[model samples]
Target chain A: MKLSHKELEIQSGQFGEVRKLALEHQMQVGKFFDAQSFVEISQVHIMADTEALGLAGIEYLENLAQYPDPQKQVWVPTITDPRGSDFKSFKKIKQNKRFVDLEKRAIDAFKQLNVMMTDTCINYQVFMPPVKGEHLAFGDTGSSIYANSVLGARTNFEGGPSALAASLTGRTPMYGLHIEQNRIPNKFFNFNVRPTNFSDWGALGGIIGKQMNSYWDIPIIYGIDYKPTSDELKHFGAAMASFGSTPMFHIAGVTPEDHLAQNKNPKMNNISLSDLNNFYKSYLPKDDNLDVVVFAAPQLSLNEMRILSELLDGKKIHPKVSLLVCTPSAVKVLCDKNGISKKIENSGGIILEGVCFYNMHAREIGEANGWKRLMSNSAKIINILGGYGYETILNSMEKCVISACQGKIVK
Target chain B: MKENVYFGHIGIGEPVKGEALVADDNFSARYDLDRINGNFSRKSHKLFNQSYVNKILVLNVAKGGVATAWMFRSMKISKICPKALLLNFANPIIAQGAAHANLPLIDRFESDITKIIKSGDIIKLFPKEGKVEILNEKSTN
Candidate 1:
């Protein structure tokens, strides 16, 4: 990957080993195609959720910190899931001054990058509002799917810290779905019928993602049987992204992919009815009897917290139910600043970090504790961690919270 | 180019004739496929799919190396345990470390202890190709 002359000149200005790596990475990325053909990013946000490699992550952050453009907005989720965070790694480290200096360095980077640094993924709606067709580099799995599929924001499924790198560089390879030609699904889902409810819609997404996970292909939903609710879309996106790598999707007339409506002989698998049953059976496990419920592994958004707060306020979790709430690094601060964290704490819940139930192996805790039924509002969590003896329920954050209080699936 | 064995293409080894529980990543293994019915009920999914318990489990990257070790420690390894192997594609030096860290339980399957091999090396061993960079373990931030 040869760096163009202009790119080489820009790479010269970067400081520190981390920033230098960021430059090298971008330059190597630059060689991928026309150097000038960069993704147009007006504002940038970095969703650096917790991963196991601390030193490597710090380096990744260092690269993310050195944003070439000062105007780019940035955000980083702080330590929300202590359980999932490499605690063993934390204990083993000889605690260098560099370790203590990590948070401050992260703060400094955020300040320099003008980052909004919120740990909450659900709150993207409040902290930032990306219009349809905006290209921004963000890494929160839920936010990534939400931004691209729901909000119509465009970005690839960036991981391995590249989202942070893109935020620092303010450009991603204008390839894949970032390119318009790719947005038109190689496959089309002809749905002359729309579902009447939310779960059905999400179930539909699960079906698609499962069938296509291996293909790395996107499908345009031609006729949705019904308009899915917020909860429905959330799970649908999570399940689809989980089984398959579907970063973005189109509902025919709803999204940009509608243009392919008339393309005869569109590539598709036409999901058989049995496959739909498998999709439901795949994520929505049948055992609903449970011992506990969990929310906030990657940290809950204000909306999620709001629902939990509203549901659990006057209510008490079943005596046998042990509910745990996790918030992101940013939300922990916001929760502190606003008092939402206190509310959950007062309700006899623990506010831990691990982004989602998938974080820190909390689902393992449910299994170990003999939780027979597990419930959550996150599609990603369900899609990723749906396999325990526990019955997994896919519902809105609101319904999930209510169910937690009542000790039953609150329809 | 023909020498590399990409994923999705079936490998040439004598098939293990067992219930294969395949997941794209650790979380999916832990969450999506453990239940016999349709609900969430468990303290943890360290071991999912009772049917595959002593069968064969092919895991992808598990939270770097530490989680891989911890995951194995939690799940009991019996005589029927599936062989574990860390997937080390030939690329940057950083990823080799990841693959080594990803499957700490690889050596437990004494009969089949094949953990770290370059992507190109897989062709000599398995002879199928489709680009098996499943979890993108290398691109960790």
Candidate 2:
């Protein structure tokens, strides 16, 4: 791979050991992909939640922080994905002190590296939005999928280690979604059913993701008569990336990358409303008693928060059921100022900032709280939590709120 | 005794020998694993309940989240990781993970590796050399 003079110098340890190490890591990755050169990235969003990082990952960060020179700090603007738990709400959520200690250590190490702890996967919405054709190193799969398809930014599924490396070096290997040739549509899909709500849109994405289930296959979907809001596509892209591991996609007239599609013909498999109904019905709970109802996985946008707030107005959550709402801290601030947070909290729902449900030790918490039957409005969350021993049910945002109130599946 | 050798793209980490755990299904540390017990925990996965530790995992491709990259590092730390990975194709997340964990990962073989190798086959991976030798014939003799 080609390296600039400064990169070569860093490789030879003229720069600090941290930069040298970061460059070495990037070089090895570049070789793996046969990347010819590095692409300068504007910003980096790292997904290093404590659950994924573990002790070794934290130790690795701490070791890097031991570097004396501040030159070892991140070269470009860098932020983080959602944390494992919100420290302010950890006790309320029954998170043990051990987890909190580890979280603190990880945060301290990141602070030393001069990384902004945005703690959001929806940084495209609240933080700096990636511009068209903008190169970035974003770690979260949902974030990358959205940035590539919706925002027309260039990135791959960078992961935590790679994103951190890119942050330190201010660049990443020019492979995967970074190059234009790889972005063309490999599969075509025409939607036979128009989605009515966020869950329906998510189910549609999940269906298509399963059909074209690979990272390399970019599916260009056609025949959407209506426009989807950012929040709807947020759930759609998140579920698609979660279920399929898909990185980039195009939606005829919808997404930014749609124009680059070589094939304009929508002569692929068609997805109908019945297929979506079956997809949702496949997760229908056998019993109505709910252990928990969640509104997260991507964390709620401000619009989603407002919708949830209005849904819970004057409704008391059943004592047997717990309603959890996860949102970005910045969005949560807006929710607080606008009284959305108070309404949800007053109705017995816990609104957490900077932490999603699945990544926040879902298995341990489920076992600790005896949460066996979980209901969520998120197609992405239900797809993930099933492996963690939760009998997941998929519902619309309104149904999920109603289920929380009734302490059972409403339908 | 006959030796069957298959070449793949040059990969990371040192060459090593281990029994093959073959599956046509795709892999993801975050989506399809119970790392604590070293087993494929996702029920829908073909290798569900199978141990991945100390084995050379042969899968078709990689799927799902970027957490796999960091998960590999922690799994290595806990000594519950596959010795190496062989895939027909790999996304950047798997490549980055293998690099971080320093695990041998060779992909982009001429044919579907999952079909060529079978479970319990003794295999020697030459990552730097981009070669995978099926040593079962030699071992039986």
Candidate 3:
């Protein structure tokens, strides 16, 4: 990898030890990918949940945070993804004290390093949305895919360490999605059915993701007559990224880069209505004894919050079922101010802020609460919870709410 | 039996030698593993329920989210991580995680690594040199 004079200086410790360490790590990754040079990044989103960052990771951050050198801080605007626990509702979710303490320690460390605690996977929806062709180091797969595919920004699926490295140095190695040639469509998908609900859209993404499983696959989707909402694309991209580790995709006449699909012939696969049904069938609930129904993964947008609030109005969740509604702090604040939180809470639902369900010590919480059969509207959450020992079922928001009321699988 | 060797792109971390756990499936520390148990816990994974601790995990590709980047270090700290990773294809998340954890990882081989390597086969990995050598062919079965 070719390093610029500034990069060389950083590598030589002209900057603080923190910057040197960050640069060295970046260089190793860059060389692995054969990156040619470094590209200046405008912003970075770091994923540093306590669950992902265990004691060693937290100590690593604290060690970097203790650096007294002024240059040890992040070079560009840096933000965070969802935290491991929401302090206000950790106990409600059965997360122990140790988990909460670890979360606080991680937060303090990130603050010392000058990172904003956005605490969101839906940063593109509630936080600063990246512009077209802008360079960023986004840590969340959902965020990276949304920015790369929907907003036309350039980024790879930067993991926590790599994103933090980019933050410290204000640049990332130029490779993968940062290059133009790599973004061109290689796999094509012909969409025959238009999705009616969020889960349908997510199922669509999962079907395509299962087929285009490689990180290098750039799938171009076609046959959509209407423009899908941002929330719809959010579920689609989030599920696709979760299921396949995919970073970017394009929807003809819908997403910004559909023009790239023209004149380019790639292997074509058709996504039919039956494909979506089979996807939902694969995750069908085995029994009616539902322990929990969750609405999260990418977290809920304000519009989603409004929709959920309406669905839960005047209906009480069954005594045996626990309903968890997760959203970013920004959206949660709006929900609180507008009484959306109260409406949902009135119906026996708990709203967790600033933490996605899967990252918040999910396995431990499940064990503590004796939760086994889990239901959620988000395809991304359903796909992830399986490894956490949950018999996850995918459904629409309406069906999930109804199931929570009946305490069983409605369908 | 002949000693077989394969070359791949130069990779990250120290050279290591360990038993191989080969699978023709993609990997994700968050989605396909039970980190606390040190086993492949995802039911759909080809190596489901198999213990991966300290073995050189040979897989087809890396898949799923960026959590694996932080997860590798966490798994290493708990001493439950694979000894090294040898994949036919590696995404940035795997490369970044391996670099962060300093776990030996080499990928981008000319052929499928899972088919070339067998479970329980003793193998030596030279990550920086981009070399993998299978030892004790008798154990390949």
Please tell me which predicted candidate would have the highest lDDT against the true structure. 3
Candidate order by decreasing DockQ: 3, 2, 1
lDDT of 1 by residue, A1-411 (tens): 344453454467533344345455544333322244555465544443332323344454465555455323332322111223322232221222343355445445555556554444554444675667888665544556667777777765544344545555556656555666656666666653344333445566666765552222667776565455554566566556654556667775455445644567766556555655564455454445555566743355555566566666666666666677766555566676777766776666666542444544344455456665666654445544444334666665566667776667665
Model 3, stretches more than 4 Å misplaced?
A: A262-265, B1-3, B138-141
| Deviating ranges (above 4 Å) for candidate 1 | A1-6, A13-17, A27-37, A52-56, A59-114, A190-199, A213-216, A225-232, A260-262, A265-278, A282-288, A296-314, A325-354, A360-373, A386-411, B1-141
The DockQ of predicted model 1 stands at 0.11
**B1-106 per-residue lDDT for model 2 (tens digits):** 2348998899889989999999999888887888888898788789989999999999988877788899898999899999999999888999999999998999
Q: Candidate 1's residue-wise lDDT over B1-141, tens digit each?
A: 232223332221222223333333332223433322322222344333334443334433322111221122123322222333232111111121212222212211111112322221211222122122222222223
Ranking by lDDT: 3, 2, 1
TM-score of chain A of each: 0.70, 0.98, 0.98
Docking class of 3: high
Which is better, 1 or 3, measured by DockQ? 3
Query: What are the per-model DockQ values?
Result: 0.11, 0.72, 0.81
TM-score of predicted structure 2, chain A: 0.98
Q: What does the interface RMSD come to for each candidate?
A: 9.6, 1.2, 1.0
| Candidate 1 residue A133 C-alpha distance from true site, Å | 3.7
List candidate 2 segments past 4 Å from native: A264-267, B1-3, B137-141
Please report, as a residue range, the 10-residue window in candidate 1 chain B with the lowest summed lDDT: B88-97
User: Residue A312 lDDT in model 1?
Assistant: 69
Model 3 lDDT per residue over B1-141, tens place: 235989899999988999999889999999989999899988888999999999999998888878899999989989999999999888999999999999999998878888899998899999998999998553523
Question: Per-residue alpha-carbon lDDT of model 3 for A287-358, expressed as tens digits?
Answer: 677999999988999999999999999999999999999999999999999999999999999999999999
